[model samples]
Target: MWLLLLLPCVRADSRCKSDLISSINITAKLQSDILLPCNFELTLFKSDMTADIASVWRESPCKSELVLSLNVTTALQSDVLLPCNFSPGLIGLNTTADIAAVWSHRNMTVNNLVEITLQGQTMYWKNYNRQIKTFSSVSASGNFSILLRNVTQSDEGLYQCDLFNGTGCRIAYQEMHLRFDDSPADGFLTWLVTAGALGGGVVLLVFLITIYICAKRSTNSSNESVSRELYPPEVPHDAVEYTLENPIYDAAVQSETHSSFRAEKGNSAETAVYTAVKKVKRKERKPEEVQ
Candidate 1:
């Protein structure tokens, strides 16, 4: 009996933990739809049964309060049912609630009001006109999404959404932005800068190459000209080197002639015959001329 009593007390304490669990997730785009998902887990204070389950929504984390609520017995096969028509324990309430998605730019607030039934049913409101701007929102997508038509700089700002029930509320927020299109002037300037740099580099390279080629050509021409100017003229292949032997031969021939002359003056027959033979041998030789 004591064990049973202790178990009930422990179970009761777990049920009323007082910590409200909620999470908000969103993705913001300029000219597109932004989806913000609201997920919550509720634990009843006295019992596990979701008899009087209530959720409230607020903004500013602590200041803004009571945006919406849900208070109906949800059908098992409804669209808002967590994890399909099954898992009845994941359902927040016995019935689906009206979830309102709000969008704010500057200080202007455009309320996109819609209802989502159990098992994720979405109700869209067409022609829900907001102010004239570069953005539009689809109020029918009960998934707390802000759909902007055309994005602009003026459309950039903060946005918020609130999901609630009878007990409390959960809030989700986001930001939007608009930017100007790039001008042709900017693009042209960029292209011109790039082209100028590339052209300058090419021109510099070509100039250096031309200078090098001219220098090489000039060097070769200079070498050839110098070689031509400094070279000695050609000479015949058969030219001979001068020597001292020619004078010696002339002296020898004159001495021989003088001796013969002396011998003839003396009228010696033997000397005359010998001189005549020597002169004949000399005439027959016909020696090469010396330089």
Candidate 2:
């Protein structure tokens, strides 16, 4: 008898577990746009049911813990789209179904951002009207994706989207974690690249300057060596040392000096011969007196 009772419970537990369809994680950059996707089929809910009993789970009441987990990372000042779409699988295209979606931030205050109803295609903004936006064809396309513009630091936390029937029973649930990107690592990488480029440029400049200086010094040294080899300095010679060392020059000067001395001696000899003749006449007069 206990086993018979447990069989239904086991089947119901398995059915509830099957409702959990998808879990997604996304990473996005700062100031960029991102989308968090959540999609499910709505075949169990009948379209012929009245708006008050639109949820099939109301009759068979499953556990409320079937939640879709989504983790999303983004930076400040970003635009994010939290998606929640349902397909009317078995429900006829001509028939209409009533569904409501509520988006809320699960922080210190469970702040409701917006509520969208598919019946009259009505949208009610609870808190952030200016920052939150949605597609006009949300009811037609069954897309309850909410666009959050210019997300701030206060937006960092868990966000939830709850789909309810007209009876106010939540049939589907999704929660997402929004966080700031690790921007410091990107900044450090950018700084590293910039510093590396600057250092390389400085090193190249220093190398070029060194080469220029070395080339200039080498040119000056080469010019100096070539000038010394080509135009050697002249050394002056002493005249007396040159004349004494040369035999031909000494002999020519001695011959010219001896000729000049002989000419002067010949003139003196002519004058002395005339004076000796007068002295001879006086000696002859002295001999006549003696005779």
Candidate 3:
């Protein structure tokens, strides 16, 4: 009864008298405020035929599963998203030109959710100060999902996402339900996620450092082995100690006394005999030598 009050009768404008309903039927999650897609048509109402547009939330016949599978629990005043994808595959939608989208809650025209041209531009219709929007991802990818921000009790209801062609023909339908309730925040889950992320990051860093150090050490050892193989180690040269005991040292010292015997490296070898004698004056030795 309340929905019928919102059904709009099209104006005499020849351009506006097209049937908004489509053959495509939509399915949604149970026991929640659902968005029910009405083909290319949206739930709309007009107080007078000349009004700019009628409200949508109070009018859409989009029904979630009457059977309660499970309730989506969210805190009041918290933002929630009710997913509704209006894929044309549901009813084999084809368009010669670009397609547009219109979203409605209950039976009203959601100007904020209206997209006149497919993938062209979006016009936002404001209800309250609240931010309700369709995802841009849906615009590009054909997934028509809307976002409800700062939800209130009044916002809990059915929703509809409809697709339209360039000719203003509605093509696809989808619906979903979102319910916000009062619930305490799960502090343990938040803390656990934070700690887990930190721990994982620390472990990853440590593992990388260990791997780098081991690789460096292995590379250094490999280089050293290669160097040793390429150039063999040389044995140290032997050194000799002399207290005038070695013949080479004694011969070198005595060679200075003999002028005719030059110690040239190219000269013929000559033997030398070493004997120690007491120092005597040459003149005194000369008398003994004459005798």
Specify the highest-lDDT model's number.
2
Which run of 10 residues does model 1 get worst, by summed lDDT? 77-86
List residue ranges in candidate 3 displaced over 4 A.
1-73, 88-96, 107-112, 127-130, 185-291
Q: Highest TM-score, which number?
A: 2
Sorted by TM-score, highest first, which candidate order results? 2, 3, 1
Ranking by lDDT: 2, 3, 1
Q: Write the per-residue lDDT of candidate 1 for residues 1-291, one digit (tens) a residue.
A: 999989989977876676756756666779998766655544334453444443332212223343332222222222211110112222234443443333333337664433333334444445433422211232223333433444444444433344433233333333333223455676798899999999999999999999999999999999999987776344331332223345345434544545544444574545544555565566557663331
Please give the TM-score that candidate 2 achieves against the real structure.
0.41
Clashes of 2: 0
- For model 3, what is the alpha-carbon lDDT of residue 260? 39
lDDT preference between candidates 1 and 2, better one: 2
Q: Which model, 2 or 3, shows the larger lDDT?
A: 2
